[model samples]
Target: MTASQDTIGQICKLLEPFNSTGKVLTPDTEISTDLNIDSVAVMDFVMEVEDHFDIEIPLNVVSETHSINDLAMVVDARTKKA
Candidate 1:
């Protein structure tokens, strides 16, 4: 798999703990609705993702992200720039 694909996989794994329903997550899964993540949880999740990817995500961009694919895209872009 490509680097982005690998990163996406890692991201999905990271989200597993937050998925209370134990449902399978996909890239298209909505972060808020599908994952049942609240605003508070979103902040914590973002922090963990930043730490995992070794990159800082801008707050504005974080707010705009809506799905797993959106986050993976942001993470991929940030990591590539680094």
Candidate 2:
């Protein structure tokens, strides 16, 4: 798989447990809106992402990120930099 695809898959795995709304997790799934995740939950999820990916995602990027694709892109870029 391409980097973006791989990243998306990994993110999907991490986000699955948070899918309490039973929304279909996809690359375009909006973290807060679609999944009904609050701001605090989003931050918690970001911390999980950091631990799983071994990359520190900046708060600025976290604030700007909305969709799963956006988060995956950040992860993909960070992994590449490593």
Residues 16-52, model 2: lDDT tens digits: 8878988888888889999999898899999999999
Collision count for each candidate, in order: 0, 0
Give the whole-model CA lDDT for all candidates, comma-separated: 0.85, 0.89
Q: Tell me, by TM-score, which candidate is best.
A: 2
Q: Scored by Cα lDDT, where does model 2 land?
A: 0.89
lDDT of 1 by residue, 1-81 (tens): 123778779889888878887778888888888877898888888889999989999789989998888899999889999
RMSD of candidate 2 to the true fold? Answer: 2.1
lDDT for 60 in candidate 2 is: 92
Poorly placed runs, candidate 2 (over 4 Å): 1-3
Error of 1 at 60 (Å): 1.0
